[model samples]
Target: MSSSAVGHVISLGCRLNLAESETIRTLIASNDVVVINSCAVTNEAVRQTRKAIRRARRERPAAQLVVTGCAAQMDPAGFTAMPEVDRVVGNAEKLLPASWTSHAPALVQDIMAVRQTAPHLAASFSAHARAFVEVQNGCDHRCTFCAIPFGRGNSRSVPAGAVVDRIAALVDAGHREIVLTGVDLTSYGPDLPGAPTLGLLIERILTRTKVERLRLSSLDGIEIDDRLFALLTQEQRMLPHVHLSLQAGDDLILKRMKRRHSRGQSVALVERLKRARPEIAIGADIIAGFPTEAEAHAANTRALIDDCDIVHAHIFPYSPRAGTPAARMPQLPPATITARAAALRASAARRRAAWLDAQRGTVQRVLVERPGDRGHAGNFAEVRLPPHEVGTIATVKIERAQDGKLIGMPA
Candidate 1:
C-alpha cells in the first residue's frame, strides 16, 4: 500500500487515466480520502468499477470514498446511488481542485459541450520510469460498440507548443522516456491552431526537446500519414513499438463496428512498418465475438494474430455496453463469447511466446522500470534483468525466454 497522508488515488482503464490519476494525486491535500478513478469502456468495465468501489469502501471504512472518471461521467446517478460513495465526480470535474472539497454531492457536466482539453500539467510521476503526457483527449468517431464518446466528449488536443513544453519539462526533470498518450492518439492536433497533424507534433517535439526516448500510445492504422510513417520508421529517438487500435480483423466486422480501417489496410501497414524496421514490434487490440460475428469472423480475427505478427495483444470478449448501437444488435450467447475470447487469447499467447524465443541471444537496450529488476526493450519486449538503478537505460544481452518474458543480463 503506497498510501500517504494525501490519501489514495486508484486509477482504472487506459494510460490516459493513469496520467490523469497522477494529476489528481497532486491536487489532493485531504487525509483519509479514497479516490476511485473508474472505467466504463465495456459492460464488464462498469461492473469492475462497481466492484472496486465496494472493495475500496471495505478497505477504508471511515474514509470519504469518492468515485470519478469515465464511469462516473457516464452514469453519475448510478454511482451516487452506491452507499459506499460519498461523492461522484465526472471526468470533466475530477481534475479541478474544487471538486474534491466541494459540498455538492454529484458533479457531472455536459461532456459533449466541453471543448477544451484539461491541461494535466503534472510534471513528474514518482512511481514510473516513463512519463505519459496526455496530448489529446476524447474521440471524434462514434464506433457502434463504444460508449466512451459519451464520457470523453468530442476530440480536443493540447497545442503542440504546450505539448513540447511539457515534454521538455519532463525531460529536464530527469524522465528519460516520454510517452505521448490519449484516447484517440492518432486523432490529435486537428482541433488546434494551424490544424497540425500528430506527425507534425512529434516532429516539433523532436526538434524542440532533448527527450531521449519518445513513445506513442495506440494508433488507428488508417490514420498513419506519410510523414508520421517515415518518422516512426526512421527516427532513432522514437521507439520501435507500434500498437494499433484494430478492433476486429474481418472487413465486414470492422465496417459494422464503424471502424475506418479495413483488414487488408491494417495488415499492409504492419508489413510496411516491418519492411522499414525489422526490429519494430507490433501490438494491437482485437475484440472477439462482436455482434453477429460468425465462426468465419472469429477465424479472421484469429488469423490477424499471425498475419499482423501481434506479439502484444489486448483481447477483449464482446461486452455490450448500455446505449451503444451494438447492444441493440443481435447478441451472442455468453458462453460463445467467452469461448472465442479464450481462443484468441491462446493464439496471442502462442504468438508472443514465439516472438520471445526469437529474441534469445539478441542484445537490447532496456529502460529499467521501478524496483530495478526488469525493464522493457525499445520494441516493448519485457526483460528480466539483475537489479539496476531505476529509470536508467541499460544494454542487456538476452540469455533465455521464460514465462512470456525475456531473461537477460546487463551488458
Candidate 2:
C-alpha cells in the first residue's frame, strides 16, 4: 500500500456526511489507514459501502481500514465482522483525533445521548471550490422509511455564533461560497437558547460573514418558516436554488412514510417560491415505489414532476432498510420499482433538458468550481465554460445546451 502524510477519506451518503468527512480528514494524520465514512440510507447504500471496503482492501492490501459514519454507527458489529475492517468507529467518535489512534476494535457510543454538535472546522476542502459547514446534526422527525435517526440520534445544533465565525474564517481562507449542511437543516435551532430558527442563523451569517455565495442543502418543505420564506425572496447572496426533501408526492404514501407535508402543501410551497422568485430553480428527492404504493400513487408522484416544475430530481427506486417500518410492510415487486423509477427519471431528464435549453443567450453568474471545465450557476445549473481560476466567479453568456449542461463563454 502507498502511504502519504495525510490519510484518505472515502465519503458516502449525503452532504452532511461529506462535511463530516472533511473534519475527519483534518483530525487524522496517519498514512497507513484509510477511513470509510459509510452511509445506511438504503440497503443499496450498505451494499456499496461493503463493495468500497473490499475494493480498498484489494488495492491497499497492507492498509488499516477504519469504518465509521451512519452505517458503522448503526451496525458496528456488522462492519467489525468484515475482514477488511480493522476497526469500527461510531459517528460521534470518528471526528475526534484520539479515536483514530485508539486500539479499540469498536468505539461505538450512545448517539442519542449526544446533546451538542462539535464545532469541527475544515481549513479547506479537497478538490472543491466551495466550503461546507455543518450547522446541525441528527434528526427529530421519525419518517417511517428512514433509519438515519437511529444512526445519527436526536437533533443537535452548533451555536449560531460558531457557525458565523466558521464561515467568516473559510471566506478569509479564499472560499467564496459556503454551503450550510445538516441532517435536518431546517430543524436547526429548536434545541439552542432562545430557540432561534434556521432563518435567523442564515441572516446572521449573511450579515456577519463576507461569504459571497451561500447555498443550503436539502430542506423539508413543511419546515419553511416565515423568516426563511422572507429571506428566500429578499436575500440575493442566498443562491436562488433549493433542493426539497419531498420523498413521495401522493398523500397516502406521504402519510404512510410519516412525512409532515401533504401532496397539496408540497405543490403549494413550490408555487409560492417560484412566484416569489421567478428565476429560482427547484429540485426534489422523490421515492419511486414505496412499499404498498399502487399505480395510482405512482402516477401522482409522476405528475408531481410537472406540477412542481422540478428541473433537478433525485429519483430513487425504493430499497427497504433493515428495521425500518416500511421494511415490514408488503413489499413491491422489483419490476414495478424499476419501472416507476425509470419513468420518474425520464420525466426529470426532459425538464432538465428544457431548463438548460432555456438558458441559451442568457447571462449568468457562475462560480467556477473547476477551471476550464465546469461551474454551477446561481440557480444550480452546471455550466461549461472556458478555463478560469478554480474559485473565480465569472459572468458567462450561455451559448448552447447539451448533455444536460449549459455551454457558455465569458460575457
Candidate 3:
C-alpha cells in the first residue's frame, strides 16, 4: 500500500463499527496503514479479528497494522502480543488522531472514565446512497450474556443539535437515507441534558432537516418510551422497520440473562407495533443455546420468528466471552449449541420466505442503492429493480420473490 493511497479499514461487527471505521479511514492520511476495527461480541468475533490482523499483515507487508475496537479494548495485550500487530488502540483512543502516530505500543484507557461522545462521529460518508449517524455510544445495561458494556463503557449520547446538523449535512450531500446507529440505541439521551428522549431527537432531526428517510439500528424493546413508540407507529418519514435486540424468548432464560423485558412483553410489543403499522417489518437478534438453555427454551426462541414476524433474524450460537456472567453458567454442549442455532436459522428462513412471498404483486418505494441494481424498501426488504438513479427513491412493483429478495420493476 502506497502512502498516498486511502488506508485500508477492515471494519468487523455492527453498523456502529462501520460508522466508526469511516472516521478511522478519514483520520489516517497514509495508505501505509491498515486498521482493524474489531468486534468482541463473541469469541468468534475475536477470532475473526485476529485472523484479519494476520491476513492484513500478509496482504500489506510494509503497511503498519493497528488494532482497535471492542476486542482490542477488552484485551489489548493479546493483540499487541501478536507479531502482525504494530500497535493496539482502544475504542476510546481510536477516535483520536494522535493515537494513530504516537509511538505508544498500546493506547488502551479506562473506557468507563470517559463520559462525553465525540460529535464528529455523527455521520459516515463511506456509503454512497445511505449514511449512518452515531447518536449514542456504549451501554448501561449489563445483560448476563453480553460483554459489550465493558468494551464500550457507560452509555453516552451525542447532543440532538449535533445529530440534526450532521444529518442535514448528509442530506445535502445527496444521501437519501440516514440510519441512527449505536451500541445501545434505545438507551439514548439519558446522559444528555434535559434527558431528551430518542423520540425527541428524531423529532428534532425531522423538523430541522430535509433528511428523506430516517432509520434506527438495534433497539432494546423495553426502552421504547411512549413518545418513541408513537413516532415509530405514526411517522411517515421514519422507515417501517424496527430491529430489536431480543436475545432470547424463554422467560426463564430471559430472567437468567438479566434482561429487562419478558417473553410476554416482547410478544405484546410486536403485536402492538404490527397492529398500528401492519407494514412494519420486524428484525431481531436471538441467541441459540444460551447458558442453561433447554430444548423448551430453544423452542420458545424459534417460535419468535412466527410470533414476531421476524424476517431479518440474526442468530448467534452462544459463545462464552471471557468475563461475562454467562460464561460461568453451565454451558450447553458444542453439538447442542450448533444444532439449536441451525434449527433457529431454519425457522427464520421459512418465516422469511413466506413474508417475501406475501410481498409479491405489491408496490414498494425503494431507496436506490445502486443504479440499475438493488436497494431496500421502507420496510427494509431488499428489492431488485430496473435501472434507477442511485440515492433516489423509486417506486417499484414486485413481480416475484427470488433468492430471498423481491424482484421488481419501475411502477
Q: Tell me which residue pairs clash in candidate 1.
A: none
Error of 3 at 96 (Å): 1.2
Residue-level lDDT tens digits of model 3 in 3-100 = 44448889999999988888888888655799999999999999999999998888888888899999999999999999999999999999888987
TM-score of model 2 vs. true structure: 0.98
- Residue-level lDDT of model 1, residues 38-114, one tens digit each, is 99988888999999999888777888889999999999999999999999999989889888779799999999999
Taking all chains together, each candidate's TM-score versus the true structure is: 0.98, 0.98, 0.97
Task: After the best TM-score superposition of candidate 1, give how far the Cα of residue 145 lies from its true spot, in angstroms.
Answer: 0.3
What total of clashing residue pairs does each candidate reach? Answer: 0, 1, 0
lDDT of 2 by residue, 286-361 (tens): 9999999999999999999989999989998999888889999999999999999999999999888888899899
lDDT, each prediction: 0.92, 0.90, 0.90
